[model samples]
Target: MNSCKVIDEVVNKGLCIGCGLCVSACGNNNLKMALNEHGFLEPQQVSGHCEGCKGACLSVCPFNSKPNNDISTETKLANIFINESKNHNTSIGKYINTYAGFSNEHRVNSSSGGIATYTLIELLARKEIEYVISVKETITTDSHYAYSISSTRDELLAGAKTRYYPVTLAGVFEKIKELDGKFGIVGVPCFIKSVRLAQKADPILETKIRFLVGIICGGVKSTFFTEYLASKAGVDVAEYRKPEFRLKDETSTASDYSFGCLDKDNNQKTIKMRMVGDMWGTGLFKSNACDFCDDVTVELADISLGDAWIEPYRSEGLGTNVIITRSILADDIIKKGIENNALTIDNLPISSLIESQRGGFNHRHNGLGFRIKKRRSEGLAVPPKRFEKDELSFLLKLIHLMRMKVRKKSLEIWKKTKSAEQFDKRMKPYLFLLSTLTKINHYYKWYSEPGAIKASLIRKKSKIFK
Candidate 1:
């Protein structure tokens, strides 16, 4: 096992899990991951110390990173579709819930509604999976890395939310060979795409990974942002250990106080901040990888879930999912669950869901591929779809900027909320962009203008990325 190979796998595959175990294990400076290409977070070499230890990295690797199988069949997707939807927005087959939700551990602790955690839990509870090869922060450090934690229902309850610091994909890479039962994975769009790429490179993953749960994301940042929030809170910084971002006790309003964290001795450290409604890429502390991301939502995942952040459907202090089950199995499970009253939902159209997700905006990355294709089809090395302030592109950049700015405020709000419902009133306005524009409407959140212009010119030189 070459260190370069391992590092490349970790970087490109990006299951890093953010454990920092490899950093400790690497006797040589040969290994490190410091803001690489696309920059959602990847591992790199400080020099080449990790260059020689193939097996060593594996020894310390957490997630059993093995490629499973290709479920890219219409039959599978169709089956899930048929099974989960109960005529309206859910699958009807053997479901126990209308939609999958677990206000359990991961949700209350998560950035969005904690749906990803619940999805994994549902899989485990149903015996559809053996262990989960997802990323988690180890007890020892704030850094995250992948770990193939076995689920007994109990373990699933333990990790149901989001970890902002680091997520290690390498751990999964190390332990994959030992597992036998089907597994599941949850990640932001880029990570899901990377996992898809990994499946292409190594087929074993497709066989084992029964579910690829995707979360719509803006991007991820370093632990620095959490630190930033904590610093503003007037807490004793030196005593910090592990920090949980949100804490709630079922109250509503400013005095209710939604977010908090924990330190080394399990002391609940509560801090407060301002609020906003958006989740994912607001770009304040997000990695550069987000800018170049081609997928706003990983279309390939078995199931894609995200906050329904648009209009009439949004509950101020709580969370609702704009769920799209890629296949029928997922659909069926959800459908049955709802009919059985194990789940509850508000029927939503795909358009409503998309609006909630703030779709329609284009960016350099969005136009990039089409730019390349347009160039290729037109007989050019690179297309010349340079950014323009014309109606379309101008609006695209505007929306992107607004999304970022709102999310920056949102991180502050999230740190203070715990209501499964009752979000700030300003957060639930539909048609945020259109509402600001001459009156359009959205599913949730207030809309204004796509006002910022940091790299407004980048849209101009997109073809010259090389």
Candidate 2:
């Protein structure tokens, strides 16, 4: 197929995740990442630069399903770190060590645990890497953040917090080509996979990008997601500026942080995330590409980091990070930091790390299987996935289907109304149904567990006595 045709299949068919590897990997420079009408970055053809080509671009796409060229993240991990890693699992991929901790200095500034920020700082301090490529505030009328390269300590720290908004690596790839230095990139799983694919296709990228730092992502959101939240916080989308998606709430738990943004007048507006409701679970403005993804912890990254959502860590007002280190060098850096008292951390079982991101895994793995099967049954284009077709209970399947509907419809509804109130009014039924079904599923599982019947009987007996 021609380059245009290949990209059309991916983009038109809703399979493109917009990482921009295809643009960077193109020898003809035929593609560029552009913001779509829905406010998510998508690769658009530069012009009529048409040519019949082998699968150079799609070969690197994490969602590509073409034969031979369609490489799995598992295969990449096996080829690169299989012999070096101390353990391997289908859920989290290969790892040398797992830990949970926070950096005393960086935690306050970071979204969670501060480990990712600290690691990037350490890599720079040790002169192991000359620069760090990460997300930072861009503050345009249309966008609040984008991928940027950081050279100084303060720059990395400025890029510390998590950004759920969609960003593409196309521009940064050109920047990497222009600048000369060793670099470490931080991104979500699919973006990291794209970098790996691009590196395989481009020699310069392979040499320049020395480390991959991954952030555990549930799914990326379109600009509308933030706009919706900003609107709910009483800021107009046109007036929105300098968004802070995760503002720590000292009086509440780690996960109960607030969302803050600057209005047109430069006044800060803040709202507790809980007050905005659980939009994340509802999949509001989530990319269609996310429904097809299966990697939960960036299994292909050198080291993956995420919020520690279990137990004491979750209770801590300052966030905690659950980390999976795949490379020896990455693990050694953590160890050195611990020894120097720059970090306070403890080795955690890999299972605990997996539990911390259980919600992500459930959606990416089980939900992915169901989505793939449904897409195939409808003769729709399904992206290549690491998981096989999974059989979910009828209720679960319906809930999953509802979530897909919610994600798909949210953008259209928001665009039509442009009013958060109208959007919420239209989506109430879907949310109510999804919430009710999810509660049923949760209760059913709770009651079906082993010893649950005995426990329930004891509770009943105690209630009668009381």
Candidate 3:
């Protein structure tokens, strides 16, 4: 089918990730990406006339068809330049090496270890790539962030931290088509996958996009997330100007979120993240498409980077990255950076790297089948997934259902919330539902299984007594 079919099935079905590949692939400026009432970035047809052109847009869309192919299929299809796999994990696909590291200069100010920023800068410095595309704060709006092209180290640094908001490649793809040069792009798994699909359809993209740097994603938040935070922080959503998430706090254990806007007196007002309520865990503003995805490590990327959420690294206030390199070029760059003292790195077991994002993996992979089944039971359409259907334990099924319930109710409650206190009051029951599931999962894991407590103690003692 054509772009129209794609809109009817994926976009209308709420399965669109808003990557904007379809808009670019349409090739006639027939489609444009814009924010919907739900604050999701979606495509709308600008021209009603059908050019009767061949539909390349449908083939390039990642969500157009069921992604039922195995991990090996993705690796084999995407990793055309790499042959051998050095390490493998069920959740984190083929990798040449895994490491924990940080950029000496950027660690403190970055959201994580700053490896992603450093790697992009290194590529630019060596002239390996002429330009890099990433996300940076929007100068004109109080909206969170937007896609930008960075040719200099300072420009790259400006986009360094994790944005945690929805960004699209419609503009970036237009620029790539116009400009002629080697390029590197940083994005989440689905975005990278869409780029690969576009590259297969267009030869110029295949040649110009020399590198793909993926960021491990839990999911992306919508503009509603920012608005919700603004409201909680006492800033009027209508008056809110600009917002930043994961603001660096050298003294605090976790990063804070903040926003700036002019008050009635025309004085600039700023609000910190704490007042906005718990953005994480609640999963209130997460895109629906994210729930259907299973690629937590961005397996299709040349190199994937994320926070080292496991012990030792997690305790360090400066932050650290769990890096998985799939391309020889990425491995070499990281190796050289370590050699020159630009980065501090150490080889870590693939297991440790997987452990760093255990929660994300469990939810995205293991819990996905149940979610799919739930949708199907309701006669709802679902995008195809690689995960196989398996019977979940009763408690696990209940937990999954509870999470969905909480997610749905939280969105409704957010719109009606008049004050932070009311927001918290209404959200308490839903949050309690999540907390109860967490406790049940923990208790079931340790108490229900024979010797589970003993095994846990041994693991803890081994770490401490070592």
Candidate 4:
């Protein structure tokens, strides 16, 4: 139940989500979070003076095994937080309400609807929370991002957009423990889960963390993704000044990915969404641990927010948010915001929320099962997951396998490329193969039925005959 045990069980097994709660749990400053060569945040023990008197680190790690009797207890606690009876979909978890909306003030500058920034501002204005912990660009290093604690409006605004790189809460958690008041936190599902786990072992965290704001996530990428994007934008990673992901463009689709960078000469450069290659599909520079994650929506948060990728809303380039309120506090805040005219929103069916993240749900829930099975077949150790064994079509299995393989190749190619053009040229064939396989898989699944082809033919013939 020491650092050694955590390394053996979680870090080595690739179950560590790199949330960095374990570092904060060790009060003696024995561990520090550092990014490895592959851009993964991992704990590095500074001092070996481990008496193992109290295994606070092990108790807080989400990946650790719990006794069989404790399963029901944990589930019951989760149900209490989730208000299980009100939940409509398992993928999205429990929510008091769902809505599509945007913050009038922050939408243009934010990655999505700006609800997260608005929510933090409201909480601060009401004196309900003293500080918020969120991710922001590191001032000294343009190629890196880090967790920051914001207490003022400008500070909150500075950290508004989505960060698509690796980040951990070890440093911020330390700051929270040092300071005195209630705080809100923003994180993806895995990081939120880590906070919940850490709270069980540390009573102070239970009292300090007054709110949890979660962002729905597909998966976290390695630092390599940032370097790749910088390379594609015609900036050397070391010479880049500041880089922002998801630079909002009013003319682009909500799903379009873009990057903005400043070079040493203070010249601005941008890689438009079209020229950046496929960010999600190719899965370049993705973390190994992300492949095993099952949570698409941040189920454990007080409230969760994500881009509303459905029609009409998706067409709006500023971006819209699909919000799910879980705790009563969050639900009340959202309702009051709408009533006060601080936000624009309309009620949305829970189905739309699920549909907005359909790809993520399928990959995390179903694709995870296939990935786990494949690992087991190869005599590799895999952590337990909730998804049951299901039959995978031949094409579906091949698509998943190839996606993983191509991602590794993409990382290699990215390292070798000296410029954006070279990276794009080298990646064309691999990207094409992945896209074609995905299309074929979907087409076969839908059109392979007997009447599907016949119906298509009849429609075409009717149009021609008319």
- Top lDDT prediction, candidate number: 2
lDDT of 3: 0.76
Which candidate model has the greater TM-score, 1 or 3?
3
Q: Write the per-residue lDDT of candidate 2 for residues 178-218, one digit (tens) a residue.
A: 88789999989888887777776677887888888999887
For model 3, name the residue pairs that clash: 66-384, 142-241, 142-242
TM-score of 1: 0.61
* lDDT of every model, 2 decimals: 0.48, 0.82, 0.76, 0.77
Q: Write the per-residue lDDT of candidate 3 for residues 5-100, one digit (tens) a residue.
A: 567768988788989888888766788888876678988888666466466666677776543343224554455533455666667887889999
What is model 1's C-alpha RMSD?
11.5
Best by TM-score: 2
TM-score of 4: 0.90
Total clashes for model 2: 0
- Sort all candidates by lDDT, best to worst: 2, 4, 3, 1
Stretches of model 3 off by over 4 angstroms after superposition: 1-3, 66-73, 79-86, 142-144, 252-278, 416-419, 450-466
Candidate number that wins on TM-score, 1 or 4: 4
lDDT for residue 235 in candidate 1, whole number 0-100: 40
Error of 2 at 113 (Å): 1.0
- RMSD over all Cα atoms, model 4: 4.0
What does the lDDT come to for candidate 1?
Answer: 0.48
The clash tally of candidate 4 reads 0
TM-score of each: 0.61, 0.94, 0.89, 0.90
Task: Tell how far residue 157 is off in model 2, in angstroms.
Answer: 1.4
**In candidate 4, which residue ranges exceed 4 Å CA deviation?**
1-3, 53-55, 65-77, 83-85, 415-429, 449-466
In model 4, what is the error at residue 57, expressed in angstroms?
2.2
